[model samples]
Target: MIRLRAHHLLCLLTYVGRGYTPAFVAQYSAIVARLNAGEGAVLVEGPDDICAPMLDSGHHCREPRITTRDALAREAVAAALGQSLAPGDTIPLDGPTIARLRENFAAGTIRAACAACQWDGLCSGIAASGFSRTRLSGAPV
Candidate 1:
């Protein structure tokens, strides 16, 4: 299973082969491929697989603001999916599920956690463009 922070579930909706570093992009791209191939995702509190590449660089994965973002993301996503999600909860990255999440993301209903995120504008652009060129499979074509 791929380990991911709750906020990453929102991030995946707009990933377009860009990231903080080449290694970060590469790692995230590979994770997206795995998710496309039907990998399961396990929710993690902080510093998940995607954050591994940045850990050595003193990344802010452990910061309080990021932790709060995670909590907000978890709450919003759980409400969107109508499921209770915890740190250890496993989420299936299936086509329908991804589609549903993307729909909610584009509608701005599940975006409270993204308010303070640096990539919010980028994500909003992606959503506005109908998720075009996003790496995630099962996105609207």
Candidate 2:
């Protein structure tokens, strides 16, 4: 269990070796639990990895290019995560819903990626309000 950003989980398959910290395990376990609990996970295919063997594995792959919209969404999520907001925070403890957003960011699937999400509307609304990187440093997303 690694305390990694959602992007790491999207791109990395293996959870490396021993002496894992409790926090790391908790964080990652939460993600796995969410995935196993039937929450939808969006795993966009990396741009250059279109021909990569990992995608060919046919396990958890989708072919979609990342885009500016996705980049904004990912940035927002990162901002929120940086705040380490609890379940009751203004941002709902929406579970591991961010996996796909991270994937979309990596794969260049900006526009069509978030069609299935409740937060899709929010993302657009926020970006429209001039969601800036500086605000990410000042407060949580």
Candidate 3:
């Protein structure tokens, strides 16, 4: 199973093979490929698979602001999925679920955690474009 922080669940929706560094993007792309291939994901508290590459570089995965973003993402995602999402909880990445999240994201209902994120504009543009050209696949059209 892929281990991911709460905020990453939102990030995956608009991922288009870009990240902080080449290694980070490589790792994230691999993770997205796994998810697209039907892999499952478990919610984690801090640095997860995606953060592995950046961990050795003194990344800010443990910062208070980042943690706060995770908390907000957890709450928003939990509400969106109508399920309690805590650390160690399994998240379903099915097409329907992804579509639902994308819909909410586009409508701005599940974007509270994105307010302070650097990729907010990019993600917003992706959502506005109906998630076209995103790396993720297998969702119903």
Candidate 4:
């Protein structure tokens, strides 16, 4: 496996969050191969290839701009929250929080709640309750 930089991971994470298909990896791989073939300074044809590090680093840098910005925002939020984050496997909620979340789910407020929730897409319970695409990445703690 090629060593991925922070920016590369950020790109992949952003695409995953946007609900892109799993085929994205293949596409990125092809782009990487092209980049490795002395085409590092070339440009990609679309936003679909934004997660490619070489593409982002060169003339085809436009597509990855938004992805990069989102990654930065995510990083800032993560820093503010600090490490040792609660895993999505367990939704940590007191009785009141659970009730409120359930109520929100019943009232079609899952989007609002998910927007406010850091766990968002990571939580299977939350995702099943509503909103599928919450966070961008699935890095295990």
Candidate 5:
């Protein structure tokens, strides 16, 4: 289960698996493994090893990260909407505010977790096309 932000949820919706490096792919595959059971979403939670962090530029994926981006997500969203996601458990990527989040991202208010991801453009394109309408292949959210 990978904990995710609006950015990651959108990226996975448009992901075609070509931009990241082999190391990144290998690391990502570990997360993909969880999808076999058909459990995937922007926000997810699973067994320890399978529950990958929202992989960011901060991750080289060669070692354990001493810090997590939970605060970054809280700050970004709270700064934008004055409320933060609790994400108590795995959350499938489906909601009414997908477009609102996208708009915030474009305005630079909802960008912390995604500022460094290479898939930024793709996610933006997907969002631009209408985030609430976009859907991932494996799950409704």
Candidate 6:
């Protein structure tokens, strides 16, 4: 099933097919299978390496792949996903959800999630640059 941390899913929105190993693409296929099923995807806020296989794709640039078991992290992730997700909520990682995220990101609604991200500076730069870039390195977009 396609399960992921909120930020990882966020990263996928801008994925332009770079930096991933072939194996990761296979894994991604499976994830997509679930996401396409509307209710087969899972979202979490703690201790799950949902994005591990694809983190090296550079879309995320070492930003956290798993949310931490903390109130702030959970809250931020929930804000990002636009739902009150717990550690194992079945969510739809489909177009509408992702589209909402994209709009929210452009409109500054997902800043809370960015607050919990290590890539905050890079994300800020992306936002500042009017989202001219999505695949960023840790070096400030």
Question: What are the Cα lDDT values of the candidates?
Answer: 0.90, 0.35, 0.90, 0.35, 0.47, 0.52
**By TM-score, is 2 or 4 better?**
4
Q: Please write out the lDDT profile of model 3 over residues 53-96, one tens digit for every residue.
A: 99888888988888998999999999998989999998888788
What is the per-residue lDDT of model 1 for residues 1-141, given as tens digits with 9 covering 90 to 100?
A: 999999999999899999999999999999999888777789999989989999989988899989988999999899989999999999867778888899999999889889878899999999999999988884222
lDDT of 1: 0.90
Backbone clashes in model 6, listed as residue pairs = none
- Per-candidate TM vs. native? 0.95, 0.23, 0.95, 0.24, 0.44, 0.53
What candidate 2 gets wrong by more than 4 Å, as runs, is 1-109, 132-135, 138-141
Error of 6 at 87 (Å): 0.7
Worst-scoring 10-residue span by lDDT in model 6: 132-141
**lDDT score at residue 72, model 1, on the 0-100 scale:** 90
Worst 10 residues of 1 by lDDT: 132-141
Whole-structure CA lDDT of model 4: 0.35
**Candidate 5 residue-wise lDDT, 30-131, digit = tens:** 554455345644432222232234355544433322123344544565555555455553544333344445567666566666656666787677656654
Best of the two (5, 6) by TM-score: 6
Task: Summarize candidate 4's per-residue lDDT along 1-141 as a digit string, tens digits.
Answer: 233322332232223233233454566645444433423221112333444434534443354654453344334323332432221212222333333433444454333212432334444454454433323222122
Give candidate 1 misplaced runs (Cα > 4 Å): 138-141
After the best TM-score superposition of candidate 6, give how far the Cα of residue 8 lies from its true spot, in angstroms. 1.6
The residue pairs found clashing in candidate 2 are 42-100, 65-107, 65-108, 65-109, 66-107, 66-108, 66-109, 67-108
Q: Which stretches of candidate 6 lie over 4 Å from their true place?
A: 20-22, 37-39, 45-77, 80-82, 112-141
